[model samples]
Target: MAFTLGSLVLLCGISGLLTGVWSATIVPVKGNNCPKGWTQLDCYCYIYEDERRTFADAENVCNILGGNLVSIHSDLENALVLELSEAGGVAPGGGIWIGLTDAVSEDDFMWTDGSNVDFTNFSGGEAGDDDGDCVAMVTDTGEWVDDICAIPLPYVCIRETFRH
Candidate 1:
């Protein structure tokens, strides 16, 4: 019996298939580990923009990238976002627009994606501000702060890996 290169390759392939040794490619998940220029923590992708923009404009940019301003779900997620913002040189009290807003109803904060509110990181007496309707993350405390949606400020964008 002669074993040619092709035959060996075929046999190996078959063996792998039979033994289930071959697996599908594991594409990177956004929330788990984001791609270049994006940070991933669980299954969401986060991108921080150092340049300031109005809350609406920032959210538009995120939309162009197929994501929305970050909608935090847990403290861990909020912490990760805070870290990303800090790494980008966003100082404490520095504002970064997130997907949170109460534009729909005063004091009725909601994520831009229409996701129901699950968790919040509001600073002491933050959402109480009467002049603001949009939410931004304060790098100093990783707490939620309401600001005027039209005010330009650095912001973070978030999207699900499945969207991309």
Candidate 2:
């Protein structure tokens, strides 16, 4: 196992390449490439569907459209979603299903998009057991509340902006 100069150089080069690869940060590209009828915010595109459907059904629809139910991670994002739903003609007092749920473990909510639950807009005493596992945003105030998954409601969907 004698080390040769060429072999040592090659090993060092490979190690350096791996280090560069591992340390690279993926910065999302912000562009105006969202699909038609979808609104772009940051790196994501969002859309609201006024059709009333149960949580599962709404999620299915979103999946069919190449996304998942919207996941709000900040107040600005939450307000944008609320605005999108309202502009799309959500009935007053009606709710719109979001992607948060604790179905796997009650009270431990997670977003279906696999994004971190870094923010929430729940109303007072929400994420409680008074309702079921699903979460819905009350159109009146854009506040979230737990609700039964079987309840039909409008929904918002989101996906990363695509480059065309």
Give TM per candidate. Answer: 0.76, 0.78
- Which runs in model 2 stand beyond 4 Å of their true positions? 1-31
Best by lDDT: 2
Backbone clashes for every candidate come to: 4, 0
- CA lDDT, candidate 2, residue 56: 94
How much is the lDDT of residue 97 in candidate 1?
86
lDDT of 1 by residue, 40-159 (tens): 666778888888999889989999988898898988988888898999998777878889988888988889888888898888844766589998887888888778888999888888
Q: What lDDT is reached at residue 127 by model 1?
A: 70
Whole-model Cα lDDT of every candidate shown, in order? 0.83, 0.88
- TM-score for predicted model 2 compared with the true structure: 0.78
lDDT of 1: 0.83
